[model samples]
Target: MSLTYTYFKMRKGFGRQPMFCMVKPEMVDNIMPDEAEQKKYCLRNPVNQESQAVLSQSQQEINTTRVVLTDTGINHLEGGWPKDIHFDDEETTSRYRRRIERDESYVDAIMHLTPKFEHYIDQNNAINMYDLFYKNMPSEDPVEKPIIRINNVFRDRQCRPTSSIGWTCEEDSKLVVSYCDKVFPINTPSRNTDLVGYLWNVELPSSPVDEFLPPVACWQVVCSPVSAPILLGGLEDGRVCIFDLRSGNSPQDISPEHIAHRDPVSALLYINSRLNNEFFSASTDGVCMWWDVRNISKPTEAMIMSVFSPIVNEYDLANAQPITTLQFDKAFPTRFLCGTDTGLVVNVNRKGKSHNEVMSAVFKAHYGPVKALHRNPSISKMFITCGDWRVNVWSDEIISTPIIPGQPQKYQINDVIWAPHRASSYMSVSADGRLRYWDFLRKYREPIVISRLSQHPLLKIKAHDNGQMIAVGDKKGVMYLVQLSDILVYSGNKDKPRMIQTYERETRREHLLETKIKEIRLKLTKTEDVGVEAPPIDEITEDFTSVESEYKRIVDEEVRNMGPGRTLSSSQLEKVKQEVRKR
Candidate 1:
C-alpha cells in the first residue's frame, strides 16, 4: 500500500485549509541519496543531548526513509534528470580529492573487511561507511538522482524589491487623459532585471465636464489591452476615463472622452471590438457607454444593464452602491460580465443584449462583496472567482445550484487569479493572507494550498501566461512572487509537447545589416546567371533606387500623418494656430 503526503502551510485567521503538493513513494525515490543522507545528518546532529537520544530512537523504527509512490506521485515525475550519472574531470576530482588526500583512506578502507562499521562507531572506534561497504559490496551502476528546485522569491531589481508601487500610466502625454495618455503594456515582466514593472502617475483635469471631468477627476491611469492602448479607468470623483493609446497628432482638438456615474466609478474594463478601432467603457453608473475612439467627444451608444431591484422596488442603478468588479470573456470579446455591490453578476453583449431571461438570474453568491471575477483565458464558457468567503467556479451549462452549497459566510475571499500558463486551474488570495489553488477538474474536497505567508488584506493578484509563477499584492502595498519550483527535482517524464512552428515575417528590428545584405545578394543571384548575359548593373541599380525612394515616400507620408499638426486643413489655419497656442 502507498500513502500520499502533502506539506501544507497554514496562515493565521484562515477559516479554510488549503492542500499543498501531493507526494508518493516513487517521487520520494527521486530524492538524491545525498539528500537522504543529509536529512539523516540533520536529524542525528541534534543541538543538545536530549534531542540526540530522541533522534536515535526514531531512526530505528523506519527501515528506510524512502517516499511511498501513488497515482498523485506520477504527476511529480515530469522533468527529472536522466539515469547513468557521469561527472566531468573537474567535478569528479573535486568530489574525491579530500578523501583521497587523507592517508586515513586506507585504514578506513580495510575496516569494510569486517561485518559492521556501525558497531565500531558505536564503541567510539573510528571507521568510515564507504571503507566498510566497499570491501563487502562491488560498485553498482551510477544512478542519476533527481534534483529538487525549491520555491523562493528571487529578484534582481535594484529598487527596494517591494517599493515603487502604484498605478502605471504612459510617459508621452500631459492631458493625463489625452488620447495617447495611457500605459500600454501593463504588468510586463522584466527581461534584463528581476524588477517586474514600473508605475506612472496620471494627472487629472481640474473640473467636472457634465458626466465627464475636465482633467481632474477625469485623470486616470488608463489600463487597456496590450495590442491597442485604450484607457479604462475611473477617476477620483465619479467619472470614467477612456483614452485611445494609438492616438496620433491629428490637430483634431478632440476632447478626451469621459463617462459619468451617479456614484463614483469603481470598476472599469476596456473592451475590444470587431468593428474598426471601436471600444466601449462600462461604469458603476449601471450604464455601459460605447465609443469609437476614432472620435471620443461622445458615446456612440449607451446601454443600462441594471434597473430597480424588483424585490426592493427602488432605482438601484443611480444609487450610491457601485460596481465592484468587472471582467471580459477573452474568447467572447463582445460579451462582458460585471459584478456589483448588490451581489449581481450581469452578462451583456456589445449589442446591449442579455440572456433570454432578460434581467438574468441573480444569485446571492457572496455574503459580503464580490472582489473579483475571472473568465478563463483559454476557455470561453467557464469562469471562477472569490467573493464573501468562498471560492467558486461557474459554467453556463451548470447553473442550478452552488458548487459549495453551504460554505460559511465568515470566509472572505480577497482576490482571485487564473493561472497564467495553464487551463482549468486558478488561485485565490483571502483576507487572511492565504494563497490557494483550485483545479476545476479535481475534487473540491480541498484545494492545493501552495503557500501561506502573513500578508495584509490582499488587494490584487496577477499571474503570468503559464501559471507557473504568480505575483500578489496587499493593501499595505507589499508584493510577493510565488514561483512554482525555485528548487524542485522534476522526476517526471521529460518529453514535452512539441510547440507548433508558424511562419513569421522578420521585422526590420529583428533583421541585422548582414542579414539584409545576404538577402539582397540571394535575390540578385536568383535574378541572374554567370553564363547568361547579365542585366545592366546601372539599370538594375536605378530600378532598385526608384523602388527604395518610393517606399521612403510612403513611409514619410505615414509618419507625417502621425504628427499632431500635420492634419490641419487649409481653411482652418486660425483653428490650428489657436490649438498650437493652447498646447
Candidate 2:
C-alpha cells in the first residue's frame, strides 16, 4: 500500500500576486493496500517432536585392563651339549667330535639315510628344481622406504588355504579367517572335509580363540562393522550364514538352501546399519540379495545383476553379469558397487524397482575379474581395484579411465587394501609372493616398500584397525602378521586436501578428453551419413564456355611473356603448348 498527503493554505495579498494563495489545497492524499501478513498460531498444546535416536538411556561401567610387555631369554653353550664338556680347548673338542662320529648308533643312522638323500639328489640333477619365478619384476625405489617386519606367523593344521580374512569390528587386536579348498572340480575328500573358520587374537598367537562352522566350503567372510561377535560368511554352495561367538559353533542364522543363490556365492558384506542386522550377498548366478538378520529365512529385498543394453532395448538373461565382488560405502547408504567377472564395475542404487533401473553407471575397471575393491576411508571420491596384473585407483567423477592406472606388475594382484589410518597409503599382495606398500604423499609414482613375504601366493590381506599391523593369508595355509613402519601407517599432515586436489585435477582432464571424444564421434557419424549417399548429379548438360575462356586467357598471358624482349620458363611454355594442342 502507498499513501499521499495534501494540505490547504489561506489566500494572502489577493489584490496582488499573493503567496497566501499557494496554501490552498497544495496536495491530496490517497492510500491503497496490496498485501498483508500475520503470525500463524497452533491450537494444539505442546506438540511432540519425534526423533530417530533411541529413547531409553542407560549407564554402565567399563572394565579396564593394563597391558605389559616382557622380554626373556635362555642361555646355552655354543657347541658342547654336556655340562662336563668344554669347547674352548681344540684338543678336547676334536676328541669329543671324533668319538661321536665313530659311535655305532651314528654310523648306522648315516648308512640308512644315505640312499634316501641320493634319490632326492638324483631327481634334482634331472631337472632344475628352483628357478626365478618373478622374472622382469621391477625393483622398488630405495628412498624413504618403509620396512615390513614379520611379527608372528600362525599355521593351519588342516592345510586348507585361506579364502577370506577380516579384522574384528573397529578393533586391531583380533581377526577372523575362513578356510576352504580352492581347487577346481573339487575332490570328494576336499569338499567333504570339515568346514571351519577361526577367530584369532593377537595375544594368543599360538591358537585361535574361537571357531566357526558353515554348512559347506566358505568362500568369503566379513565381520560386522557395528558388532564385534557378528560374522557373515558366503559359502560355495550359495548360502549366506552368520555366526556369533557368544553362541555355539554352528551358524546362528542361515538362508534357506532352496531360496538362496543357485550358483556359488562370491561376495558377502555387512552394511553399516543401525540394527546391525542388514547385510548383502552376491553370487555367480547374477543375483544380489539383501537380508535382515532378524528374519533371514528369506531376503527382504532381491534383484538380478544386469545392465541395460541399448542394442537389445530390454534386459536379457544373456546380458546378466556375474558379480565377483561387492562394496558398500557407509557414507553412501543408498548406493553400492559391484564387480563382475567381465571386468566391469556396476554402480547401483538399492531403492530401485528393477534390475535395469537399479544400475546407474558402469566402469570398465579391469580386463579380468576384479579381485579386491575398496573405497578410501579418508577420501571417498577415490576407490581402488585390483585385478589381472594391475591395481587401478578410480575417481567417482571420472569414468573413461582411472585417475591412477598404476603400472601393471609382473604377477597377478590377489588383494589390495587401504590403511585404516593413512589416507594416501595402501598395500597390495600379489602372486609373486611380494608385499608392495604405496604412500601417495611420499611416493605417488612407484611403491616405496616391496618385501617378499612368502614363496606361495598371498591370497588375501586385511588391515588392522590401528594401521600398524596387517594379516596376510597365503595358499600354504599360513598367515603372517606384519608390522608396518610408522611412515607407512600414519597419515601425513594435511593429506586430505592434497589428495582431493589431485583427484579433482585428474577429473577435469578426463572431462575435457570426454568432450573431445563426443565431438569426434559426432563428426564421424555425420561423415558416415554423408558417405552412405551418392554424390549429387546435374540433370542438364552444362556448356564449357567459361572454362574455354579461362584457358584462352591463360594461353594469351603465356604467349605475351614469350615476346622477343621477355621469355617464359621452359616448363611454362611446354604446358601452354600442350594445352593448345589438346584444345
Candidate 3:
C-alpha cells in the first residue's frame, strides 16, 4: 500500500469524521494523469479506498540564488547621429535641426499632433484624479486627556533617589541612572552608606544590567553619544569621576580633593575637544572646572562664578551666590551661560584677552535659585529656565525680561526639558509629583497635558534622541519609561515658521519696552532747577550717569580733604547733590 498523503492518521472519535475541502480545478488537473496513462488502468470503483485514495505529496525546499549585482556606468558624450553629422559642432547641429523641422512629414506631424495634445490637456484640466480631496480636512487636536503610556518601570534594590538619567546606544538601548541621597546636607547619611549607580538595558528592564561605584555619592551622570561603556558624572562631594561599564564597579578616574569644588557639583556637560574627553562641571562652590577624562588630577581651565565671585571679605565667601546650573552651545564655543543661586543668568565670554573686559551680561531671572537652563535646540538664542514656582521662556536679545513669562505653578518646578522634536513645546516635572507637557504653539499661558506619573517628587526627566521615549525619575529611585503621543514629538510644516514669528513679535515688544523704560528713567531723573547748575544733563533726561559721576567726584574730594577736626559740609556739595537730586 502506497502511504503518500497530506492528511494525518485517523485517530479516535473526532478524527474519524470525514474531512471536506474544495479542490481547485487546476489542482485536480495537476493530480490527474494524462489520457495515455489513464487508458492503461481501469478502476472498477470510482470511489475512495486506502491505497487508491492516497494523495501525492512532496516538500521542495526553495533554493535561493546568490545574485551578485554589479553596477556599471555608460558615459556618452552626445546623442546618436548620422556619420555625416558632428554632434559637437554647433553650426552642423543647427543645420540638421532646421532641415528636420522643414521636412514635410515633420510639419504635418506637428500640425496634426495639436488636437490630440489639446484633448488630453483639456481632460487633465477638467478633473485631476491625483488631486487630494481631503486636503482641507480639519486636523484633530491632541487628546484633552494625557496619552502618555508607561512602557517600563525599573526599581532600585537599595532605594536611592534617581539623580540623573542618560541614554546611549549599545547592543541594546542603554541607560545610566545615578542613584544617591539627594537630600544630602539636610539629612546627612553616614560614610558607610552605599552609593552604587546602575546601568540599565531598556530591553531587559527588570533589573540593572551593570553597576558602577563612585568614590563619592554621584549626583549627576551623562553617557557619551558615541561610547556605550564610558560614563562621566559629578559626585556629591564636588569631585568629578568617570566610569566604564566594561570594568568592575570602581570609577576609572576621579578628581583630586585638593582641587575639587568646595561644594557638590550641580551640573555637568561635555565640551567638544580633539580627544572628545573634555567636559565642564558647575558646582555650588561658585566655581566651574573643565576636565579631561584621561587626566582628571587637575582641571584644564577654571572660572569663578563671576556673578557673586568677588570676595570683599571672609563674609562674602560664606554668603557668596553659587553657580547652580550651566548651558553651553557648541556653535558658540567662546561663550557659555550659567545660572546663579541668586537667580542671575550670566553669559560668560571666554574670548576676551583682558581680565576686566566686560565678561558677562547678567539678567535677573527668578526669585529663587535657578534649577535648570535648557537651550532651545532649534532656536539658538532662546532657552527656558525653571526655578522657584515658574518656568519662563527667554531670548538672548531681551536682557530685561523673558520673552514668555509663564505664571507660577502650584508647586516649585524641579526639572524642565524641551521636547527633542517640537520647537514650541517643552516638559516640566514639579515637586507635587505631576508632569506637565507644554505646547506653546497651542497655548502659551498653561500646559496642554498634565499627567501625574509618580506619587514621589520627580527629580529629572530626559527624552530619547528619537523623541519617541521619555524616561522620568522620581525621588524614590523609580524610573518610569514613557511613550509619547505623535503630536507631542512631531510638528506641522508651519510650526517652525510660526514659532519664529512668535519669538520675533515678542522680541519687538521687548525692544519697545526697553525704550520706554529708558524714557521713564530719563523722566524720573529730571530736575526742576535748570539754570542753577554745573552744566547738568537734560533738565528732563532719564540717564543719571553724569549726576552719579559728579556725586562720586564730590564725595571722593570730601573724603580726601578730611582733617583732624574738620566735618563734611553740604553747602557746595548740597548744590551738586540737589542738581543730581543728587536727580
Candidate 4:
C-alpha cells in the first residue's frame, strides 16, 4: 500500500528551519513509485536568465532532455536524483535496501519500511526545493514552492474497534476516569457487563460517597485475580486510597485502611487480588510502598527510597526523583519489580523480614530513562519494556548478560504490557508509535506480531485477556480499540499497517471553558483582594454572553461528530473502509 503524508505547518519554523515531520503510515498511503529511468542532469549558473534563454532559443530545446539544477541543486542532489551517482550500479547492488536492512535493532526494524520523501524539488524534479536568489548565493525562501514532492501513499480499508461497546464505553458507563490526560472507563465489557454493578467508580463520586469529600483523582477499579472487586484509588492532597470493592457505592471517602505513601498515587496493583489485604501503590513522589489493608496508614515496608542525586539534593531535597512503575509478581505475591526515572530496576521480595526489600538483582534498564515496566503473567523470569525501544527478559540464573539474549535497538518504549492473561507473550508501544507483540521463547530480532500504527504517538496500551483486541491511546488525546486479528493479518501479511478503526475525543475545548469558569469563581472569591473593582455588572454579563455563544458553537461542532447516529455498522463500516483504501 502507498502512504500519503499531508504536511501541515505546526508551529512553523524550528530554529529558522522548516519543521519537517512525517505522519504514520496508517494515516496515509505507503507505496512508492518505482520509475526506473536514466537521465543526465546538470546545474545551471542563473536560475531565471540562462535557463529560460536556452529553452526559448530554438524549437529543439523544447524536446531536449535536460534538467536545470538551480541554487536548489544541493537539495536536488541530496533529495534523490541520479546526479554524481550511478543509478544502474546502486539499484543493481540493492545498496538502498542494504542500508535500510542493516538496522536490525528493534527500533530500526520498525522504521526500516517507512517511506522516505523529500521536502521540496524543482518543477523538472531536479533543483533543490529550498532554492532562492540571495546575493548570488541563495535566499532562504522559507517557502519551498514549485516543488514536485511525490509521497508514496497507498489507500486501504478503514477499520473499526470490535467491541460491542463504543470506544470509550460511554454507552451506559456514566463516569470517565482521567489519568495524565488519558481517560479510561471503569466499566469494561470483558470484565463487567452490568453498567452500574462495577465497583470502579464507587469511591470517586456517587450519592453516598458524596458524604466524604470528592476524591482529588479518579478511582481506578481492578479485578482481583478473577472476579473479585478491588479499588486502586488516588485521593486529593496526594494520598493513596485503597477501597474494598465490596464496599457499597455512596459518595463517601472511606479512609484507606492502609496509608502507604506521602504523594499522589499514580498506579496501584493487587499482589493477590484474591487476598484482600495484599497490594502495592506507586506514587508521584517516587515511593513504591507495599501494604496490607489491615495495617496502619504508614507502610509496613517500602522499596527503593525516593532520593535525589547528590547534585539535586544539594539544591532541593523536597523534589526527589519520581517513580514511574511498580508491579508485583503475577503468581508470587512476595516478588515484585519497580522502575524509576533514575533508570534502575529494583527486583524485590516482599516476604523478606523487612517489607519492600530489594533482591540481589538491581540494574540499569534503559539508555535514557525508564518509562514503563510490566511482568509477563505467564512467565516468572520474563518481563518486558525497560526504556528506549528495547524489551528485556531476565532469569534468576543470569548468563553472560542481564538483558534477554537478543540484539537490542534504540526506540522509545512508552508502554510495556503483558498480553491479556498470557505471560509467554507481551505487547509494547515504542517512541516510533509501532505496536509489537513478542514471545520470549521465540526469536529476538523480529517480533512475532508487528504493527505500524505510527501516526499517533501511543502513550498507553491495554489488551484484552482473550488477545482478540487491543486499545491504544495517543498523546493527542485520541484512543483506539483495535481488533488484534486485523493488525496481525493486515500489517503482518501485507507489510502494510492501516487503521482498522478509529474514534477520537478531545477535552481541550471543554477544559478551556472550565478554566474560564474557574477564573470567574476565583475572582468572586478574592473580590476583597482586588480592591473591589467590579468592572460593572453589565460588562460582566456581556462577557459571559459572548463566552456562552462561543461555547455553544464549539459544542455543536463536537456534537455533530458524536450524534446518536455516530454508531457505525458492518455495511457502513466496509463502505468507509473501501473509501479510505481507494484514497
Model 2 residue 564 CA deviation (Å) reads 55
lDDT of each: 0.48, 0.82, 0.82, 0.49
Tens digit of lDDT per residue, candidate 4, span 1-583? 7688777665655556557888776656677655453235556887775344454454443467678776643334434534555655757447765765676684575665443433232333875557664658754523321111111211111221111111113222212222332223234322212222121221233221111123443323333343333344544334555444345443323345344345545566667666556667675566666666665366666654433232311334254556666767657656777776676666666555432243445656665556667764544555555676566655443322344433564666777776654334567777676777764434345677676764756666765545555656555434444555432312122111111110001123334555788899898879968678768899999987876666555545555776865655567555554554454
Worst-scoring 10-residue span by lDDT in model 3: 308-317
Candidate 3 residue 403 Cα shift, in angstroms, is 0.9
TM-score of each: 0.43, 0.64, 0.65, 0.42
Best candidate (score: TM-score): 3
Tens-digit lDDT string for candidate 1 (448-562):
4445654555545665433444556544434555556421112122211110010011122224544777799887787676555667899999987876666555546655776
Tell me the deviation in Å of residue 451 in model 1.
2.0
Find the 10 residues in a row with the least total lDDT in model 2: 534-543
RMSD of 4: 34.7
Q: Tens digit of lDDT per residue, candidate 3, span 253-340?
A: 8888999988888889988666778789988877778888779999988776555444321233454458888998887787888888
In model 1, what is the error at residue 69, expressed in angstroms? 56
